[model samples]
Target: MHADTFGTFDDTLASGPRRTPLHALHLRRGARMVPFSGYDMPLHYPAGLLKEHLHTRAGAGLFDVSHMGQIALHADDPADAARALEALIPADILGLRSGRQRYGLLTDAAGGIRDDLMVARFGDRLVLVSYTTLRAPETGADL
Candidate 1:
């Protein structure tokens, strides 16, 4: 309900003053915010991205990737999920080991590309996440 939400950007509706519960917490903890994809996102805290990336590369960064969508399936076993997955994507996703990720491309029945994305098996379910990219979803049909 802040006043800045009503502001116009190039005569179009732009993102307004929205904050996550952690947003206030980050601000309280001296976090810096930046505009990314029309949203006020936290770019860095007292520690910068280079340092954070180095920490992740060296030890652990504990990034806040809550923006990502997480999914899990429980139809059958992992092999079943892989079997269901290979029907759509061109990659041999079934070959992926547990906790491993693989990249694949989506092609039409005629082998025309739609987009490329990654598929990974975390524990029991095959998780898929993509934004504004071509990813072959489960079409529920025999390939």
Candidate 2:
């Protein structure tokens, strides 16, 4: 109950919204729930943001971010994976080194930014993921 209604920033202030599977786990962890961006999410935990941030900086905050936005790729070669990712991004996906990551942007033909996102080579496939989805329709990539 505390996690469900404990903080001024809990986006879960409302009664309904989409929740990831971690919702149950967060509830079990004493996270303060709140509403945000059309979803129910946690604003902070029992220690509060200030302490949580400090602990993280102090190396005492072991974190589990399994519930965060994640994307995976499956391909036979790095080139193949980069090609697949390139189909959606304007960035030179093929230029990224095997273990490196790069920030990518999707832009319209007119040069307007559609979205800003990330792309990385994981294993042999190109993995592109972002918190926001945007697109230029033709390229179908908004980062």
Candidate 3:
């Protein structure tokens, strides 16, 4: 897979967009590269958006999501971590079991949404998938 095949770069921009780990691979597979979330990702493969969406709905599809931010919380006990996260997001984090995933919303003091994220419990740690495009919580104290 050659990076050159990943689509033409936007020379008009001040700087080139960041490439993901699968940039070359996507190009080799005839993917159409597009700038998204500060990364050059595949907008759709040769299969096109409709077929790709249908394929994902019908079975499964692989996507390169290296642009999203990942936050890991560690604690002595899984329950403690879950509880700590529950203070920040309006979701049943304490009720989430190992290997379970849930959608959560991070809200401000005024009850406005700061962002949406995905929370998953795995062993004694909690993994959070935060969208880079949305504002995030300032600190643990803010929760």
Q: Locate the minimum summed-lDDT window of 10 residues in model 1.
A: 1-10
lDDT tens readout by residue for model 3, 6-62: 122233553767787789999999998888755788888897889999999999988
Q: RMSD, model 2, all Cα superposed?
A: 9.8
Collision pairs in model 1: none
Using TM-score as the yardstick, the better of models 1 and 2 is 2
- Ranked by lDDT, the better of candidates 1 and 3 is 3
Compared with the true structure, what per-residue lDDT tens digits does model 1 show for residues 1-143?
00011111231443464344466777886779875444456888787878878988998665443332233444456677676657667778778877787777656779876555456666765444332211212321122
lDDT of 2 by residue, 88-126 (tens): 667888888767778876566586766665665655554
**Which runs in model 2 stand beyond 4 Å of their true positions?**
1-15, 58-76, 83-92, 95-101, 126-128, 133-143
Against the true structure, candidate 1 has what lDDT?
0.53
In order of listing, the candidates' clash counts read: 0, 8, 0
Question: How do all models score by TM-score?
Answer: 0.52, 0.58, 0.76
Residue-level lDDT for 48 in candidate 1: 80
